[model samples]
Target: MNLYRIAKWVVSIIFYPLFRIHVIGKANVPKSGPVIICSNHISNFDPPVVGITSPRSIYFMAKGELFENPLLGKLLTSIQAFPVKRGMRDRNALRKGLQILKAGHTLGLFPEGTRSKTGELRKPLAGAGFFALRSNAAIVPCAIIGSYKPFRRLKVVYGEPIPMETIRESKTSPQDTANIIMEEIQKLLDLHK
Candidate 1:
């Protein structure tokens, strides 16, 4: 097996016992085709938490600083995570994101751009809109409620897919499109609360 799948297996084994994992609306995930997963970021551990349970391997875009160390960089890449500068508009990240979708793979983006310190859903970033329009990929809205809770039964919910058709029909601006995506994710989290 390739390193990516190998690393996923190893990490999934490790995460299985660490958290009380639960998935909602997972069936909405398409079995194939391009997909973009938009989610709220509550903690640094959120990526790996969702990664282990994801229906397919998801390429994650992370902050550039997280890859400073050589060994850690290799490890992150093994898990299909690459670095992107947070500020100053990261073209590299955008380009890589489009490529993933073009190749018919899944890509996960934390629309808030940073962790939500207050555990509330912040407005999503514009990059989400850019990718959705450029790649014409189906967007999956996901929410991880209770991620900020300490030692509690954590819930990670995946909402239904929001097809590009819906966005286009609504005549949404690219930025507003990102907002709509996050709103759906928020609704799911609110449903469980």
Candidate 2:
């Protein structure tokens, strides 16, 4: 009956068929809890793929440019996306993200900051780890395979949840934690190939 649920259904129903998305390891997703879905960015389509495939609402930090269309922006906001400066502090973006996580929901993040042109995994931006650490949310390292191509058979693999305690116990800085998550995502992609 609410707008967010309606928007989520519309997006998911429209996207899943067009993309032919294959979601694996969804069992790894906590049925109920705050989670950070740390992912490998491959294409512009990546965010929609993750959002539709998720069993729960997942928020992502979107580029400010995406909200240029007032109508589309309203729809995106309904499904849990908000704008943030791509490479700047963008305090508003950061606040929105943290607030989403703190409110006990999944917040999607591409640690790489942007898509990888070669479909190869890139070093994660420091934000992923920082947000997880700061929010104390479990990080679900996810890998989206073959999305670099338009309308391809995209596979999204969800690895085991990386506990916040493990991240802190490893004695790695937030940047290092982000890198570790990225590496784990890359390995998952390689495994499916």
Residue 124 lDDT, candidate 2, scale 0-100: 78
Per-model lDDT:
0.82, 0.81
TM-score to native of every candidate shown: 0.91, 0.89
Model 2 residue pairs with clashes = 111-125
Q: Compared with the true structure, what per-residue lDDT tens digits does model 2 show for residues 56-172?
A: 778888888889999989877876788988877777887888888888889999999998888888777888877877786778888888754446777888999875686787767
Worst 10 residues of 2 by lDDT: 145-154
Candidate 1 TM-score, true structure as reference? 0.91
Q: Kindly report which residue stretches of model 2 are placed more than 4 angstroms away from their true locations once superposed.
A: 147-152, 169-171
Candidate 1 residue 116 Cα shift, in angstroms, is 0.5
**How good is model 2 by TM-score?**
0.89
lDDT for 71 in candidate 1 is 94
Residue 183 deviation, candidate 1, in Å?
Answer: 0.5
